[model samples]
Target chain A: MTDIAGSATRVADIQAAYLAQARSKRVMNLILIVIFAALLIAGFRTADRRNAGGFWDGLPNILDFPADVIGEAIERAHLLPGYLIKYLPSLIETINIAGASTLLGAMAGLVMSLLVTRGLGPVPWLVGPLRRVLDILRAVPEIVIALVLIFMLGGGPVPAMIAIALHTTGALGKLFSEVNENASLRPVEGLASVGATWTQRMLLGVVPQVAPNYLSYALLRFEINIRASAILGFVGAGGIGYDLRNTMSWGAGKFDEAAAIFLLLFLSIVAVDQMSSILRHRLTHGAKPGEIHR
Target chain B: MSAQALHQQTRRNFNRKRLMSFALPGLVLGYFAYIFMAFDMAGLGVRVNLENARTLVSDAYSYKTHVTQDNRTGAVEIAIEGERKGAYAPGTAPGWVRLGETSEIDLGGGHVVTFGGRVTYDVPGYGLVMAEPGAGGVNASLPDGALPDFISLSKNRLMVKTDAGRLTVTRNRAEVFKYSLGWELFFFTLDSPYHGMSPGALFKAAVNGEAGAIWQGFVGNKMWRHGDVGWALLETVLMAFLGTCGAAIIALPLGFLAARNFTPLGGLRFAARRMFDFLRGVDGLIWTIVLSRAFGPGPLTGSLAILLTDTGSFGKMFSEALENVDARQVEGITATGARPLQRYRFGVIVQITPVLLSQVLYYLESNTRSATIIGAITGGGIGLLLTQAINTQKDWEEVSYYIVLIILMVMLMDSVSGWLRRKLIKGNGGGH
Candidate 1:
């Protein structure tokens, strides 16, 4: 009977200890949440203070611009089709810039990935330096390159293409190298045994293993590049964004044209986003039973 | 499962693989061919400005100091990059420039230019070129024989260009440009007392308790604007932090409302999801343009633009995570007599917090870059400074400086976000 009493006390002691730990954990969480909330409020306040217009003052006027644009667009609904057709060439130019850059970037990224991946690369010493090159490339904003190139290349699609391509190479290189790390080396070794060159081995042995993943990533990058190309165009690299900027500068009356460009841009972005998602889904998760060899 | 059928299948697979191997590259090549014409690659050569390229490349690594003599007053002035802020004091000049009535500028490598009543450039391998700026325009004399391509002469102006330096004389002034390596006036402007001090001397002066003055000079540097740059960098990071964290906050509840399992009302879920889609589809560029109109171009505008676009993304992603959550945990919490809110706090929130945190942190790093781009559009942060510097076209060194800072900032953010992700999401799962 005395042993049973001791056991009951031990159970009570364990329960108390657990409860104390639980109480401290709750307090810590509460403190964290409070701090987070405080930070958010402070950040918003600081931003509002620094802003040209106060947040509260601007809040009511937020919908005014959108409403005006929409109203004008409805009034000029008949001209909308003409404006879209007129800007079709520019839109196509923007899409082509993205496509060409994605292709070029993917190609360069492929080579860089093969050269930088640890087990797959021919030169072991080059890995660190090449990785840094990719890092710097990835770190640079596309607009920086595009602006400089626009100054030198005279503001066209080419500068945007080159800028986007360079950034893509850097971003895709890093991603591709990661994919390369996961690739099996058995096929590479088999190719090497037959005295295949490094390029050949990488192309035949490694690429086939990682092709689907690479394509998926490249497709995603293409969607991003489309946005980047449009932004670059706004800075005078020549695309639908250039037209948008021109119309925007004209203000009041030309807002309908701006609205049309906005509509086209939105629809295209949504279409690309949807299409790429479907393609990426196929590339990643839709491998049929007989497609394992790929 | 006959041998004949298996052999036929293998042959067919090989044929398809071989066809694909050739067809893929062919398709790509055809696309590139079309792109070549579409982008007007053939016409690009004529439009390319090699001179601007040369200037950009040379200006990036080197700076020019201007030594000018006004014809009207016969007074010589030496300034770095011809900027009034970088002008040497009335009686002071660099060692390469000898300040006197007849100031001699050693452009290095036997290229010496004398500026006095008339400007004379002594070319080592060639002969001396002299020009006098007077009422009758720059009467210039060059070495005998065929005129070299380096020298261009007109009735009013004469310019002698060499690898070492360049000399130009017109009716108004005679000027010499001496190019040197590295950014000039980077640490302290000529107005600063510590302008020309060596690094060792600076250190010694700091040890002598002049550290504050030295730092003041460096930070308040009019030319480089180090203090402004520091603030810009901070503002950029703040934009990213506020935008990303704010998006996560706004999206968490919206994500739950959009999630199929969490919100029983189909219409509410559909509305929430569509709201996300519309927000994302409009794109950050449009958001930036629209918000800048209301906010009038500042960090607030940039952060809001990022916040708006990322809310859509985070909402969609978070809802997916909420839907995929295990139901057993919620059931277990409910069985313990927990209320609806308590069940979500203990079961649902705990399960999704790591996923949400990791995604939010990942967006924080990328959003830094986005914030920079938006800043350029909205006229805030380092992006504005970068664009302003680049637009000047003559401040390539500053452009390079901003580029380096941007790269460092992005990389630093990248690593910080990675570290936080690892710490917060330990053993739970991985992030994109």
Candidate 2:
């Protein structure tokens, strides 16, 4: 009894409370476990003969002859350091695709965001359907949009740009609206008190507050678009992916070269990401009270 | 016009900054319209329809078959294994042969077969086979041999022609030869049965072709595929989750450290205030890829990546929540001379647990959605599935199905997370 009493009362009480919570959550936990199990079973059950002629074949291909892959990679690795320098052309292209797409997407997102912002639009006519459109727009995968755009633009940088922009608008628009919604009502209210119209208050007061956030989000979208742009070439959009398609098609087993490109891309993204975080921190935490960006 | 009327005009211009409200939406719509026109939706629909028609034809197998042996126009063929002789109609269901590499057909009874995607794709239809010439290329360019007498009649008048002495195939495996984005788009599309001509296959073909040793040459670097695309997707998710958890863990301790009402030591509280500034200053992706390369791949790199990224994010969120907490309970802890950790345990942590949970759930939802993309680049998980899909262009309908599954998984996670947050933070389900 003394030993039990010696235990910290805070720890014991907290444990007791946690246990109470867990006991109540048992039903839910069990239900989730069962649901997850069922899903897993269904997925596995459905997984039939794989790699009839796709990535699955790579396994058999690998096991059957490791030398082919290894030999090519080793040989390619010799020339890869020099080939790595060649990534610049694609990198520049990627920047262009991302920049153009982000510019286009931000414009669309800005409009849709404003229309859907409950605080700004308030009226259902503007808010309701726009929100649904944004939802549907986001619902479809970006690749599908890319596929559809390929039809129109005929598979160059243009289709990929348009596809990225469309999806980005929906995603960024949602974020923008949240920024608008959380916007301090003080400035807007003060503007209204001075008899400024709804539109006027949003501009002089609302726009200024949320601009930094919008910019940050737009920059983030650009980073994403850059990645998307690089991949678009798999479908013939443009960039280094076209080269990848060819290399894989050749099956010369130049995995080392492919691996190098991958390594570089990952590193570059990391750099971009660091910059974004710093920018976000500055925007959010730098300013004082009302000076803070929405 | 009076002087007052002129003054009113200037005031109107001042307030007219609101004009962006009306002009802006219209302007945005105008730009959207311009983009839509630029995409040329009508042309793309036609191309897709053409491609779909070709696929539908191949899949449907609603064609008549005819074979000419040397000069025998009408088909009169006999099998030798059991010496079974039979007269077959020119156009009839032969039975099914497994049409795709992934899709296997029984063809037990006839040529009609059933198939499915890892699940079941058994459909009733005849898969025509070239009887005499053997199952070879559609176009018979067999070297040093006379054309054997066999023909396959498949969907859309599937017919094999013989040139001089070789069998010829005209069916389009891919339109990549077209020299347009259409060809690339066709190749880009995943979800097809044919494997050889797809981007991945083409690469393999080039590798195996005379260009085998080109991989070792300066020219070899041109083969650098978008392999990293796979890992990027994995890296994104791993970092997002771990970073978030790290942030929560750090914030919990620091939050207590900063809770002035709970901690009589103002010095410790001041230090806590600076934790968020330090933590939240870096992006999650940066943290992950750097770690991945440093640690040399796998979830460890991803975990560290997430830890670095999320610490900042969660620290910010948590500190904000700490500021809004009620002071009364915290003050009560201070009045008792309890250690700093004890007061925080009693005062801040308990109070903000619900808020922390809700935010975590929200972040998890976001991270899960983004996780696929990171995995794509990092060479791990389902992003691999997606990357393979784009690279191979095997069959997109199946890809669509997978996409739907992922979305449902995300939605399920979101709902469950929300429910847990609600239940835990504001508990009230018990009679005890």
Find the candidate with the highest DockQ and give its number. 1
Q: Give the distance in Å from residue A122's predicted Cα in candidate 2 to where it truly belongs.
A: 12
Docking class of 2: incorrect
Which 10 consecutive positions of candidate 1 chain B have the poorest summed lDDT? B423-432
lDDT of 1 by residue, A167-204 (tens): 99999999999899999999999999999999899988
Q: DockQ of each candidate's interface versus the true one?
A: 0.49, 0.07
Residues forming the 10-long window of minimal summed lDDT in candidate 2 chain A: A46-55
Q: What lDDT score is found at residue B101 in candidate 2?
A: 30
Clashes of each: 0, 71
Question: What DockQ would candidate 1 receive versus the native complex?
Answer: 0.49
For the predicted complex of model 2, DockQ is: 0.07
lDDT by residue (B1-432, candidate 1, tens digit) is 999999999999999999998999999999999999988999999999999999999998999999999888888899999999899988888999888888999999999999887889999988999988788989998889998999999989999999999999999989999999999989999999998889999999999999999999999999899999998888888899999999999999999999999899999999999999899899999999998888787888988999999899899988988998889999999999999999999888889888888788878988888888888888889999999998888999998899889999999999998998887677444333
Summarize candidate 2's per-residue lDDT along B1-432 as a digit string, tens digits: 899998999789866866866896787667656645544545665545456445423322221122112212222221111111112222322233223333333423332222221112111232232222223423222223443344434332223322211122223220000001111212221122221254576566567763443223222221112233223333434444554555566666666566554457988777765555444332343343334333443444444444555565565566667776777887899899978788877776777776677777676666655455444444344555655654445334334444655556555655666787677556732111
